[model samples]
Target chain A: MLKIENVTVKSEDKVILENFHLEIQPGEIHALMGQNGAGKSTIAKVLLRDSHYDVQGMISFHNKDLLAMNTTDVAREGMFLVMQNPIEIAGVSNAELLRTALNDRGKNTGNILEFHRELTEYCKRLELPTSFVHRDVNFNMSGGEKKKNELLHLWMLKPNFLILDEIDSGLDVDSLKLVARSLVEYYEAYHPSILVITHQKTLLDILKPQFVHVLKDKHIIKSGDFSLAEQIFQDGFGASTMRNGETNE
Target chain B: MNRIIVEQEEVFLQDESVFFTEIPNSLVLHVKGNVCLALTSIHHMEVYLEKGSHFLLEAFVFMKNQTSKIVFHNEDDVVLDFHLSCLYEGENTLEVNSLVDKERVRNYIRVRSVERFGSLLIKATGEILENTRDAFYLEDIQSLTTHQERVKIIPNLLVSSNEAICNHNATITHVREEELFYLRGLGIEEEKATQLIKDGFLKSILQIEEIKK
Candidate 1:
């Protein structure tokens, strides 16, 4: 479970997220939908303490202050953010990274052979070739491949909370299905809470998120079930005209 | 700190012979005649190749004061490929110079070096003689430095031939911040992440496919 209360994020002289708030319960999948530049990804960046922003307000994970934690420390506390544009890192292989992550989290107990076997099986489930295991992380990978690689990390890290930032943007139809199925399977098996940020209805249709929150004007302006997402798809975020937790705009 | 002179000439062969040896100190080798040779070592060596010949050289060495000067002369057709991997620690200067003389012949030269460490100066020069037709040269130097230790890498290509194709590129970089962030985001601690990046940087250069096992 994660909670953000009246968080305001600013960079230099510009306000990115003002009075932004979000809360996710355990085993609940929440979708954050917004137009471009609506501070959807900014929430994820703030949670990770990306260091580029100046943040105010309280962000807590399981009653502990998440805002006070460093990025790696927050990750060690079982938070994983699937970045919008996964970085390309040359010379670091996927297997090496996965092993380091697993080992650091004390999930893999130095059994490299067992880890490799498990990773290969996960790659198969994700419809990725095992050769990707040895290749550098996201180096020269297609956009869909990069998304799948993020899912691979999810499978390997198995965090308590997963934040996916525009994870459906560049995926092809099949890759979208694969990613959706992986997300559902991961949730079903691990019961980790998820916050999916997107503007795609196709992705929402796959994951079937329980709660859909519309991010607008630097805050969550509307919250409802999946129908709200469908309504937004039909009408638009502009049609809401509702302020945060208020009936009137 | 000793030196050795190795000279060979008047030998004509058509098959490829490989010498895989590690020599300490410094060496000067003069090789001539018509032959195709492959030499793999971890020491300083100045080699001269004459007549129509093809030579392949490989040096996988951790440096502690090493220097080399190599020259090639071809009246017919000659090819040279040099691959080096170096690791520098503390303070050191490694200088290497290469010259190719092309006279009515076809020549190919390629030098690839991957150097890592701090407080090191790597000077590499490649030159092609004038009136040389159909000569090509490539020089690639990469440097990885950590800490405040300084790295000065100079890769020079001097081509005087009108019919020569030469390229020289040098890049000196610390560990990239984005790369470090990507690793740390996966929960890898800082020091371990740096070591992993360094390992990857070094191993990526070895283009070996098959193991002799």
Candidate 2:
């Protein structure tokens, strides 16, 4: 459903990703595991067409070039990226944000009352308080609350391709379980292609990724199965990437 | 001049009622309600209140080519809450007088406070054009009381005025370059970043009033 071919991304006169190529079929959960400054997040940003990077090569979703589309257009084409640090826009309520997203997809507008009712139910399942809907988007919320709020947007919008950027970080045990279960349920229901990026292996254990890619030195050094994540957890990427050597052909 | 005096101990409660008056002299009114008072050429108006008399006074003044003034006087141990807004686009000269002569004189002009449990909002908006010199004088005297006043005056003045409070403070500033760069680093464009700042400012004002209402 998504393809990236020989893409190189540079930011601030430094190479972040070089010749990175990957493809994900529909209903596949691809987990990207790498250490700090390993260009994992940079890959996500590049795919989102972030202007900070001077990008080269092709990134297409359903055969449509992603680099040519604006952020709103990319969003309209069923691509959603949950940021690592979600921005808090003070006066814009969560409900209004969801309404805009739903309306942008040309969904049913007359079912707003039903939509709000369903949102409350979803928030309750996610252990978010009922007042979360009325509060401003992620404004003054706790870390766990912000993660849950992002999950709330995921449940409401239900985009085609979901990019989870280190969403497991800084979450409590209960929140992590809730977020994991929510993703599992969402994948089971809609089966949207998912990309879970993380340095930790705990969430990967729960989500059970199909493919694992190791990003290092501005490129993907190794691509393997979910067992590769456990091997990295046990032996660490330092020895694995050293054995694999600088480049993967 | 028909003068209706509100006695010191009188309590007026009129709900959903309309009052029409052509009174030229000062009308000492102590009214409490969901009421509307339509007055023409009202001069020297004084409204006094007693203790625990919940009142709402809405004075609509229509001064056509005449000098008109409305004065408000608050009594001791009384809560005089007023919301006064005028649309002065005529050639007539109009002046508003607000006086707080007692303790606990809380004035909430243009914006309301969510922290305070019980507060008063005195909001006014006026637009004057075509050689109209309008004066809005707010004299707030407080002793052991708190007053919060916010005023917004939007006038497209063709001619300058020295007699009125014509201190026009106009400012045009672009978004900070650092803020723009920060947003751009997050993949937001320069145009979208500028729009976000403008929308944030406008949305904050509207949100405050929405909470007040």
Candidate 3:
């Protein structure tokens, strides 16, 4: 369960997000649709406590003050954000990072052999090579491979809450289907809460979020079921949004 | 592929290794064959590579109270790949002079130095003589230091051959904040994350994979 109440985020002297609010219950998947630069990804960054932004108002994750927690603590508290553009870090292998992260969270990975087996299995399921385990994190990888690599981390970390920021972008049709199917399977197994930010109806068609919220003017202006997403797909965000007493006119 | 322990003051190396063997004070070596050489515990050393030989040199340096220099002489068709990893905590100057007067030679030098205290001065020079055709040389150096500890990198490429290719680059940086944020976002603590970044930096700068094998 996560709650955002009248959250205001600012960068330097400029305000990037104002009076933004959303709430997600356990096992609920919410799709946040917005135009370009409508502060959708800003919410994800602010939730992860990216030090660049100045945040105000209240954000509670599992009834704890989320804004007070640092990025590491937020991750330890079962919060994971898959950024639109994953960073490329050279020389730090994926296995090394995953092991360190699990150890820091006080989660034992059983034994070395078991951990290697599990990681290799995940790589196979994701259609990535086993050698990726030793390769640097996201370095020199293709765009589609970077997306799948994030999903690999998702499987490894197994967080309770996920903020998926444009995970479907740069993925082929088959890769998108694979990613969506993986998310559905994860949902069925763990019943984790998810916030998916996207403009693609194909991803929404597969995951089938319970609610759809359109972000505009720095806050959620409309909330509806999957039909709203379908309506936007048929028309556009402008036709679906009611801005300034008009349909986003 | 032969391993050699440097017991004498001078030796001729042809397919022999001196890894984990500290040189006594100083030594002179005539090198041949394709080899991975690690110069250890030597304040001053001289190396002569045979014509048409390939050599890979790796060294992780930590010294105090004295300076160190390694001078290299290259014959025709010789290939030299040098990786120098340095950790400095006191005033030290390390110089690597590669003298080349040969045709169809390649010399690549990479230096990675981290200054935790005091200061470090790295001078890497590649001198190519005239009429040396089809020669190429690269000098890349990266250093990390805080405000109190200073690091200076000097890459000297004195090439007299018009038909030679030469490149020199140097980068000095402190710990980057964005990289730290990325690691911390994955639940790694700040201190450990910093250490990981530094370790990664050191590992990547080596660029000599076959040497480890």
Candidate 4:
């Protein structure tokens, strides 16, 4: 469970998120839909404790104050963010990197043979080739392959809270389905809380989010069940505008 | 320290023979005749492998003191494999020159190879120093043999190579920025990411058997 209260974040003398508030419960998928520049990615970056912005407010994870923790500490506390664009490290192989990551979190006990066997099985289920384990992370990979690699990290780390920032943007139809299905399976198995920020609704069709919150003008305008997402899709954000005069022109 | 003088037009070749053996400080080797010398130096000394006759020379210099030089002259059908390394805290220099008669009858030579028709020149220099200067040179005349000559140079200097070879190449690149960002996003710190890159680079170089032992 995570909570953000009256979060005000500014970057480069420009206000990104002002007085934002959101609560995510355990074992729930929250779909955050917003137009471009609605500070959707900003929220994810703040949750990841990125130092690029000057933030003022309180962010808590499982009742522990999150704003005070560094990036590694945040990760060790079971938070993982899959970026919009995955990075490509040239010579660092995926298995080696994953092993280091796992070891850093005290999840690896130095059983390399067992680790390889488990990683191979995980890759097989994710429809990835075994050779990908030896290849450098995301280097020279196609757009679809990059997306799949992100999912591979998710499966490997198994963090408590997952934030996916526009993960389905450049993915093709097949890759989108693969990524969405993996998230659904992960939720069913591990039941980790997820915050999915996207503009498209096709991915939500696979995950079937528990709640949909429409973000506008650096704040949530509406919160409703899964039908709210369908309604916004059939109509538009203007169709579900609240009676409150908080709507921006 | 005692010294051994090698005269010209002489061949010093024996099975398991050590020239400049146990010499402490200075070694003067004067060459004039056709000479073949296979010498190994255990202490730091100045060595001259000069050539006047058709010669074959193989010298291995290990753990030198102040400085060491391997100077040679015109010879035919000559094979040279020079392995020079320094472990002391002093300066060292290795100068090598192979002069061949380009206009005379074509002679065949190989440095670090076997069964090659043309002439071959091989120079191997390895140094492990705290504060010292180590140098390697290979000079030759053009148009002597029909075969192509190949030169392979492997230099590993931990500190600096100031005013050394103009072809000095130093590869000390940091990790990719994108990789650092990706790792940070995954909850790994920037320091850990950089250490991983350094470890990977050193591991690749350590894979060489000659360098590992």
Candidate 5:
């Protein structure tokens, strides 16, 4: 339910992405693989309208003009980006941030008791401590804990469009499994569209994306099925991108 | 554990936890045991800790076009834990001086993030007298303001003791853009996001949580 066409993004007078294009139908999972500085994460930032980049393109979400809207509006329209590194907020508790967001999105947060129960249940499901609800957002958590904390927000906000940027990075084996399973459960429950940007095969082996696209030279170069991801992991991006000479068409 | 009005003389406090809403005109304090003071506002004040004392002070300052100087004198076996949080709007100057003149004295001064709107000049000086054995001192000042040029922090450390340990740090920064992006990406408006970040920074003063960078 998302379409991006002929998008060119530039930051600080430097061209980062040139005519980048990708599209995803409803309930489809797409994996984007790229090497360092291939502009894979730039796509997510541009889609969220970071305003640092000079963007020229047309992006539509559910037939709505995505590029015209601001970051908050894009988020309000069911778009979410799990950043590569979650920032630490010193005193803002997760509960407060979540509650404010839920209320701003017109969700019924009036039932305080129900809200507390839902948060507690989510914590238990995610294997996080119940005290994390009141703790500051990613204040002093480990790498694994920070990822789980982002997942907690994921479950609470319930965004239908998720751009997973290195969601598996810095995760231990067990936390990776937990995160993968939680994502699977969320997908099964809501069937949201996912554009996962990753290099590892562990998460892809579980999520099993329907489409896999390789990014190079500021644009997507190849589009394949889950096998492409396995092939890239088995070999490398240099070898995999060379195999498919055709651009994503 | 008691709240008493400070007279213009030496008040010896033993095992007392006090909350000073406003600093009196003048006074000298002596702590016999562990003592704590939570001051909401401060002015031109001088505090002296007699020999063999422990003190912890948390002060919050919100000022506009005001100047304040606070001096502290520490004696032998005296420990001082000082935390100051400032929010300046128009213009202000705050200077804090701590004198560790005796043996085995420890001083910790933390100027928690100074939120500035117009201008602010913050100076923190730590002086360790000569021949003092095992004198430890540290001062850290941080400022968060969009007007980086308007906010200035001068951390001065003067130590004459050869066996003393003294350290100072200073930082000035504006609201982090990446942080705002993360918050706005969660559907919170920009205005609300900025406010939340500012509020969190100020309130973090009272919390002793470790930050994992």
Candidate 6:
């Protein structure tokens, strides 16, 4: 469903991603494991067309040139990137933002009442208060709440390709389970392709990504199955790099 | 204090009472005791407060091409609060002057608006006499405009007393960048996101539910 080839990313004078490449099929879940400053988040930003960095080479979505599209166009074409730190905007309510997004998707505009009813229901499952619908988006919310709020958008938007960046960070054990359950449900219902960048074994265990790739120094250096994630957790990123297969480590 | 709803173009308040005026012009009020006044779509006004009195003005402007001036005098142990919300097209000028003469006097004012093809000028001045003790004055003004809207605000605080506390702030701009990014990240087009931001900015002033009823 997604392909990246010879993609080089750079920010001003520094090289962030050097000739990076990856591939994902329909309904496949991929886990990207790396330590801090390993350029894991950069890939998400690059795919979303973040204007801060410069990208080259080809990224194809459904055999279409994805790199040429703007951020909104990419999003409208069924790609969603859940940000690591969801920004807070004062005065803009969560319900309003969600409503605009659902309407822009063009598929959910038939029934206004049903849209709100479903959104409120999703908020309840995420343990969000009903008042959250009227509250400003991400304003004064705790880290866990912000993550759940991002997930709320993910469910409401229902993009075909999902990119989750550090979604498990700052989540307590209970919220982690709830989020994992939400992801599993989304996968079962929509069968969308998923790519998760994370360090937590508990979250990986829940979603159970089909393939795991280790990212280091701005490129993917190793590729393996779910056990690679377990090894990375136990032996650390540096040690697990030596035991990986399907790549020249 | 009696509660009365104003239904005329001109209103005069000489006694202690709560006045609710909708769309009035030329108001002259003198409060000897305590008064709570709500003015909606008022065009012109002058207000004066006597010693040991309290006054609150909730003024909303939804008219085009209006000019207004309001002056308040505070004697000993007097308090005044002014809240304003304006949304309309064309040019508007609102001037406010407040004077505090003796001890334990306080005044506060705040104005907010969102407009299109609108020009607004707001000038607010506060003066505390040297003989006054423990006087306080504060004013906060903010305007968010879109599509060829113009706004200029000047808040002046003149204090001759050492024990007086005075401050003022004025901010005028369109939807901010980070705010736009936060909305556009959700797949909303730029124009629609800007409209949403504009709507949220003016929601507090519009009072949609109250108007719907």
Question: What C-alpha lDDT do the candidate models reach, one value each?
Answer: 0.74, 0.61, 0.84, 0.62, 0.86, 0.80
Question: By lDDT, is 2 or 5 better?
Answer: 5
Better model by DockQ: candidate 3 vs candidate 5: 5
Which pairs clash in model 1?
Answer: none
Candidate 2 positional error at B92, Å = 23
Enumerate clash totals for all models, in the order shown. Answer: 0, 0, 0, 6, 1, 0
Fill in the DockQ of model 6. Answer: 0.46
In candidate 3, position B212 carries an lDDT of: 57
Candidate 2 CAPRI grade? incorrect
For candidate 4 chain A, which ten residues in a row score worst on lDDT? A240-249
TM-score on alpha carbons, each prediction:
0.86, 0.61, 0.86, 0.62, 0.87, 0.85
Residue ranges of candidate 1 with Cα displaced over 4 Å: A244-249, B1-21, B32-43, B64-76, B104-117, B129-134, B146-149, B159-163, B208-213
Judged by lDDT against the true structure, how good is candidate 5? 0.86
For candidate 4, the per-residue lDDT at B117 reads 25
Off by over 4 Å in 6: A108-112, A242-249, B1-10, B14-26, B62-69, B87-94, B115-121, B144-152, B172-174, B202-213
**Could you tell me the lDDT of residue A44 within candidate 2?**
75
- Native contacts, share recovered per candidate: 0.61, 0.09, 0.66, 0.46, 0.86, 0.48
Could you give the CAPRI-style class of model 4?
A: acceptable
Model 2, range A204-242, lDDT digits (tens) per residue? 999999999888877777888898888899988875665
- For candidate 6, write residues A1-249 as lDDT tens digits: 889999899999689998798999989999998889989988988887777788889999888898887777778878888778888866678878888887886766568788778888989988899788887888789999999988888888888999989899888999989989999999999999999999899889999999999888678888899988888888887677753443443
What 10-residue stretch in candidate 1 chain B is worst by lDDT? B1-10
Order of the predicted models by lDDT, top scorer first: 5, 3, 6, 1, 4, 2
lDDT of 1 at A182: 89
Pairs that collide, model 5:
B1-B17
Per-model C-alpha RMSD: 4.5, 11.4, 3.5, 12.9, 3.7, 4.1
* C-alpha DockQ for predicted model 2: 0.10
Write candidate 2's Cα lDDT for B114-182 as tens digits.
111112222222222233233332222111101122212222222233332321222223344443432
Query: Any runs in candidate 4 off by more than 4 Å, and if so which?
Result: A240-249, B1-178, B200-213
